[model samples]
Target: MNRRIGILISGRGSNMMALVERADGYDVALVASDKPDAPGLAWAKSRGIATFALSPKGIGKAGYEAQIDAALREAGVEIIALAGYMRLLSDDFVARWRGRIVNIHPSLLPRYKGLDTHARAIAAGDAVAGCSVHVVTEELDGGAVLGQAEVPIEPGDTPEILAARVLAAEHALYPRVLKEFVANERPNPA
Candidate 1:
């Protein structure tokens, strides 16, 4: 049987959309968002996928994640994919999911760990920039990279332009990596 997956997104969730489109043998059990109005939640709902949308607003991180945990568990989610999820998960939450959580980062990770990756790369005058798919750990974007897709930096390219290119790469790279990840991450069936 295919694993039941839950996707967490904060914004438009292009990567989540990519996963939904290519879910050949997997189940999208749920798509949850920290922002109640995240456009992606509606898209998931339209596809008949169960969704949970809430705002972290005044709630502390622990409280917010507790709600998320309940939702994912209630749905019997087997894997958690973070796609454009802006909030930072607490260490305890990260530990609980350890190898079961995967995230996609805009930059090639370990290089641009925080926000504004495209602009950071452009400011540093890097010739190439890309995205990374990795396991989610306690540290931000510090997990082992499973795959990367490089986009050449064109001359006079602004962050917006570079971001567009990188986003395209992410849409493609994330799905491919996620498929393989699920295939290999299983325990041996006896």
Candidate 2:
């Protein structure tokens, strides 16, 4: 069966767009966001993909996560992909969907576990940078890694430059990983 995917985004959703354009054996069942004005919603709509918005502005974290869970179940989504989704999901939610949700992070995880990774790496004078595709876990960015693609941190490189390079890898890695996941027919440890 074609993998049914639901993507959650909070911004431009470049990775989501990449999946939509490249996914030949999968169905993008829904594209959802917490921000109604998120550019990605409009982008998804333009491509005739279903879109949803649930604002967490007033609703607390638990309430918001509850809604997300309901939404995913209602849509019959088999795989959940987080693409630039800024909010950290609740532990209960992550556990409920463990082995089914995946996220693309801007750093080769276990190295730069949280935000500002590019800057932190550059400031620390790291020689290389990359992105990771990993299974989602309760602990932020703490999951078994599926795959990663690295780029050299050139001399005098700014965070912005490094970020762009890493994002390019992200755009390529996520879909490839998803394809492998579907082909293997297993809940990969990552």
Candidate 3:
């Protein structure tokens, strides 16, 4: 069966666009955001993908996640992809989806779990930087890694340059891992 995917985004959604472009044998059922004016929404809509925006600014985290759950269910989304999504999901929400959710974090992961990873790595004098595609768990980026790709941390590289390289890896890794997941037919992680 073709997987039905719902993508959540906050900003430009470069990774989201990569998925959309390569979504063969998969249905992009929905594109959702917490920002009403996310550029990704416009891009998805132009391609005729269903879109939604649920702001948590006033609704609180649990309430917002509930709305997202409802929206995903309504759209029959079988896979949830966090592509530049900024919010940390609630534990309950993570439990509900389990291994059905995936995120591409711009770090080696289990190393730089939170933000500013590039700057931190550069400052720490790391020779390599990378990104990870992992199953989303309640424990931040602590989930099982599905795949990763590394990029050399050239001397004097800025965070922006490092981020670009990581993003390139993400665009390649996410679609490949998603395809592998469907092909292997592995049971969703609990």
Candidate 4:
């Protein structure tokens, strides 16, 4: 049986769209977002995918996470994919999902752990930069990498230019890695 995956997004969810379009060996069970007005939610809804969106602004982190957790469980989601999800997950949330959460980072990882990855790579005079799909942990983008795709940084590459290329790589990398990850995970007990 295909594993059910829930995707979390904070914005356009271009990665989410890619996953949905190219899904194999797994099913996208739900698309949830911290930004209620996120464009991704609408796209998911239009495609007949179950979606839940709530802003965490006033509910506090704990409450917000609880609601998200409840929704995922309710949807029978076995894997959580962070696709352009900008919010930092609380340690509690990470611990709750543990090995089942995965995220795609814009950098090669173990290099640029936080934001501005493209800019940092350019400033450091790096020749190549790419994307990584890794298991999500408490530390920001600090998980064991499952796979990576390298994109050469051209001489005139600005962060925006580099970012666009990396995003394309991410779209291709995330689905394949997530499929392998789901296949490797131990099945839940009946």
Predicted structure with the largest TM-score when compared to the true one: 4
Off by over 4 Å in 4: none
Instruction: Please report how far candidate 3 places residue 161 from its true position, in Å.
Output: 1.3
TM-score of model 1 relative to the true fold? Answer: 0.96
The better-scoring model by lDDT among 1 and 3 is 1
* Rank list by TM-score: 4, 1, 3, 2
Please provide, for model 3 over 1-190, each residue's C-alpha lDDT reduced to its tens digit, 9 standing for 90 to 100. Answer: 7878899999888899999998865779999999989999999999999999989988899889999999998998878889999989998998899778889998888889989999988998999999998989989899989888898999879999888888888899888887776565454532
TM-score per model over all chains: 0.96, 0.94, 0.95, 0.98
Worst 10 residues of 4 by lDDT: 181-190
- Model 3 stretches astray by more than 4 angstroms: 185-190
* Backbone N/Cα/C clashes per model: 0, 0, 0, 0
What RMSD does model 3 have?
1.9
State in Å the error of residue 1, model 1. Answer: 1.6
Where model 1 places Cα greater than 4 Å from the true spot, the runs are 187-190
Q: Candidate 3 — worst ten consecutive residues by lDDT sum?
A: 181-190
The lDDT ranking, best first, is 4, 1, 3, 2
Per-residue lDDT of candidate 2, residues 10-93 (tens digit): 999999999898896678999999888999999999999988888997889898888877887788788899999998988888
Worst 10 residues of 2 by lDDT: 181-190
- Let me know the TM-score candidate 2 reaches against the reference structure: 0.94
Identify the leading candidate in terms of lDDT. 4
Candidate 2: stretches off by over 4 Å:
185-190
